[model samples]
Target: MQIKDRINAFINLGKFLSEIDTESNPILNKAEAENGWFTQDNINFALNSWAKALSEENIKQWLSNYNLETTAQRSKIVAIIMAGNVPLVGFHDFLSVLITGNKALVKLSSNDKTLLPYLANHLISIEPKFKNLIEFTEGRLQNFDAVIATGSNNTARYFDYYFGKYPNIIRKNRNSVAVLTGNETEDELTKLANDIFRYFGLGCRNVSKIYIPENYNFEAFFKAMFSWKEIINNNKYINNYDYNKAVYLMDSFPLLDNEFMLLKEDNGFSSPISVVFYEKYTSLESLKKNLKESELHIQCIVSKAGIPNEVPFGKAQNPELWDYADGVDTVDFLLKLP
Candidate 1:
């Protein structure tokens, strides 16, 4: 199919998914009953991003960034081993593969097995030519023209060993951050709260931690965030938070708290499960050095400064159209490969 035809198909698909009962599907429904997960909202988030990615200006810009042609000239085969920290975590990779006119062999995560199949069906329905391009499988993948794999730190080593030997882009576990200059507006803090709390803070894109100016006032941050206390009070999220809080407190670990804040210093690349950690930075210079020292562990960057210039910050879980993990344009490269 033509580029315009494919792009229109995805836009139409988004309009369709906006109203469907995501929980009606067995794969998606399980996450909801089991964890009170908001699958529909997660699906909607991806669909929104899909629509954005398909926009003519945005698509053209993204392709130009990747040094890719927009006339759908490539026809390579791509095997995408998608990570599923949250629902539709693999959607970006799928979009990259589809829009670039490559065969995509996608392997879905057990945690989020529903949305991929549903979207795959929808794509085929929208552009039947894509019917031959998208396939969901659990089987061993080929060396293929290119392979894009996203997984944990441990599993990433395995992906590196196997796929690294080939023309592949294998992503390891990465985290986002929020840099607080102590000048953040309430609305900015509120948006940061969404970055932290959405998807119950399960996605790697979730801002698992923060970097604030040393001795900055967190009182304002808490005041702004707790305004959406209903989200903080969510059972799914509170369970993770409370459980981690109890463990840290029981261990006699020191932390600051009011009703909605957890403040502490951590040495690990990430905090314990369900907990958000913070480290102090005296200046942006030191922050840059810290990121340089921690380069292998960082992911997307979020800030009020439009697109990020550093490795990562506050926009941990919600990635925009161009925010591929590991700072690589794996999809565009895959499709462009000769």
Candidate 2:
């Protein structure tokens, strides 16, 4: 298929996603049945986000940055090992491989097995040529020119051991964080709540940690987090919260609790569900340097502190089409494949 044909097919798929009625969507029910974490609201959020991103204008503009006309001649097959932490997490890789006029051999995450294939079928119905461009495997992956895999740091080691000889983009675990100046507006804090509670904090883009000015008061932060108090009603989240809280209490660790989420002073980036880690910062300059040193471990930064490439508070989940994960350009990687 030509580049134009591929783009047009995705544009139509976006329109289909935009028109889905969550209240009446059967696929969503089946997804939730397979994975309890795939709640209706979160699944629709992922669908709608992709819908907005796949617009003709957005896709065209994003593609303008690259030369894709030459990509068709290579016709490579890319192996994609998707992560199932959040709904449709691997859709970006799937879209990249196909839109660049390359074939995709996909291995669906067991946690997110149903959604992408269903969408792939929709794409095929829109453009039958896509039937030749996409394949899903339940067994060993073979006959692939390159690989794109996402997993935890441990699994990433396994991917490296196996796929190291090929051209690849093997991603390891990374977390997002926020730098708070302690002067954020109520609206900004409310928006930050979405970044925190959305998908129950499973996404890499979620703010798992925050840097607060020393002596920062917790009153406003707690009040702002109240907006997501309803998240406590989720059984899995509450169970985690209860268990983690008990463990912390047994260890006599200091904790700030608001009955819904726990806040602990920690230097770590990855926080458990229903908990957000926080650290006190004395100097912005020093903190920026520290963050710069740890860039590889961070997916994105949410801040108004003027750090380079910082994502504004509450906008972490709404990544643009160009926000490549792990600071690696997937399109450029594909286009350069020999």
- Which has the greatest lDDT? 2
- Tell how far residue 325 is off in model 1, in angstroms: 1.8
> Candidate 2's error at 117, in angstroms?
0.5
* TM-score (C-alpha) between model 1 and the true structure: 0.86
Off by over 4 Å in 2: none
- Segments in model 1 whose C-alpha atoms lie over 4 Å from true places: 18-39, 64-74, 232-234, 304-318
lDDT of 2 by residue, 1-338 (tens): 78898999999999999998888778888999999899998999999999999999999998998988877788999999999999999999999999999999999999999999999999999999889889999999999999999999999999999999999999998999999998899999988898889999999999999999989988988899999999888899999999999999999999999998999998889999988999998999999999999998899999998988999988899999999999899999999998
Roughly what TM-score does model 2 have, to 2 decimal places? 0.99
As a whole number from 0 to 100, the lDDT of residue 303 in candidate 1 is 64
TM-scores across all candidates? 0.86, 0.99
Cα lDDT tens digits for candidate 1, 1-338:
67667666776776666555554666566654543565456655655555555556665566565544443665777888888777777787888887777788888777667667877887788788888888888788864777888888899899888877667778777877666778778787877887876766667767777787778888888886675567555666667668778888999999876555466677555665456788887778767777777767776556653333643334455455676777787555765576
Lowest-scoring 10 consecutive residues by lDDT in candidate 1?
305-314
